[model samples]
Target: MTARAPQFCSMAWAGRPVAIEHQWIEAGPSNGPLLVFLHEGLGSVSMWRDFPSRLCERLGWQGLVYSRPGYGQSTPRPLDEPLPPDFLERQALEVLPALLQALGVDGTRRPLWLLGHSDGGSIALIHAAHHTDSVAGLVVLAPHIMVEDVSVASIAQAREAYQTTDLRERLARHHRDPDSAFWGWNDVWLSPAFRDWSIEAMLPALTCPVLAVQGQDDEYGTLQQVFGIAAAAPHTTVEVFASCGHSPHKDQTERLLDLVTTFTGASSPNHANI
Candidate 1:
């Protein structure tokens, strides 16, 4: 399958004229549901690395993949501008809704299935929790519902790598401004106030079925992340991959795709899979 070119849309968000970068994977049946792929903290449409296309192909699903503002070809973050502790809240409640509105997606039209990773996953949960009627289901990979020491350490090490290693140059290949991507995520995650950030209260509000997947060896978060999801949300399933790291899509693509295909089923079946 050929990849679609990246497209741009302009909207005011986060106090600026943000350019949202997005791409379409394939066309399924006209009445088919839409699977929107949300990238990781430092991820972009390019950073998804063909996983979305491959997954969409497996399930005969169409997908919309986008790079959030300050990542990939989207609007770059202003220098010296620090994101608020409520950044994740803003993305879920403000930015995502605006993008969906611009694209004419809502509860009335075609169904929406969010496939989010890392930071993206958290955003998906928040959106689904608040706008329960807008989503059919969700498949979240390594989402952070609460802060952990392990996550903080891994991010700290990443900061070291970015400064002392070639990680900056490597990330530059996918992002227009690497600093915008890195700092946008890093600074917020490392702050003292951010450590107190938690979305557990919002969990009970999730109305749709959810599939939470994570790696056994994930450095950023522990299994509590997924377990906590199950505790708060009744309609949820958890899948843990052994010998895997933070990114299950990258470390266990074949297995992850299978899990996603089964979990999401034909239309992210609005039923329990546990």
Candidate 2:
């Protein structure tokens, strides 16, 4: 489960060119199923730590982990312009496909399984909804289908923390420009227009198998996030883990791994070999 060095891929995003930081975790077989790991808001490749490597090793699948445009060691967001309300949509629709194409990941030849956390999970859902044939399945952790009051309250607290506490200093360890990563996500989420943002309508369009996992004590969101997903995509399997928060991979790693192993095994039986 040793991790390799970070790699960079150049692409255009948000009307400007940028570089994305990424890594590949190869295991078991060269041609085994690929699982792409998407990080959360204010998250980067380094922030994921060893989760991708461990998951790929356990599942015997190849893994791809990356930092979105404004996060990690990749290109920083422009200081002058604030991100638009549809930023997440642009990431899923524009950034992801272009990056995959640049990396020679042809989903038609081999569809990819996405493992996304929080904001990343929302991106995965949007991508699958638009490109049904290119996605195999999805494992979404604390994904938001609709913005909740609790989400706003937490984000507001984060804003306060960023200004008053040492949160920015800590985030600087993961991101090249903490302001770019934090404000780009924070400003939009707390915006008046973004309050009405919802990807719930896109759920019914998803044809891939989905496993929505959430924590019972998540401060950022509620179980309604997964429940709304289940209501729309009746085929989805939903799990709410007790004694867990926004991050199941961090708080309940073992149980989360077991759940993913079982879900992926059933979804892609051939790829679960060790």
Cα lDDT, all candidates = 0.89, 0.90
- What are the runs in model 2 whose C-alpha is more than 4 Å off? 269-274
Which candidate's lDDT is highest?
2
lDDT score of residue 214 within candidate 2: 97
TM-score of each: 0.95, 0.96
Best model per TM-score: 2
List of clashing residue pairs for candidate 1: none
- lDDT tens per residue, model 2, 167-225: 99999999999999999999999999999999999999988889999999999999999
Superposition TM-score, candidate 1 onto the true structure: 0.95
Task: Compose the digit string of candidate 1's lDDT tens values, residues 1-274.
Answer: 7458999989998667889999987757545677899889999999999898898888776789999989999999886998889999998999999998897766546667899999999999999999876788999999999999999999999999999999999999999999989997999999998999999999999988899999999999999999999999978999999999999999999999998888777444432221
CA deviation > 4 Å runs, candidate 1? 266-274
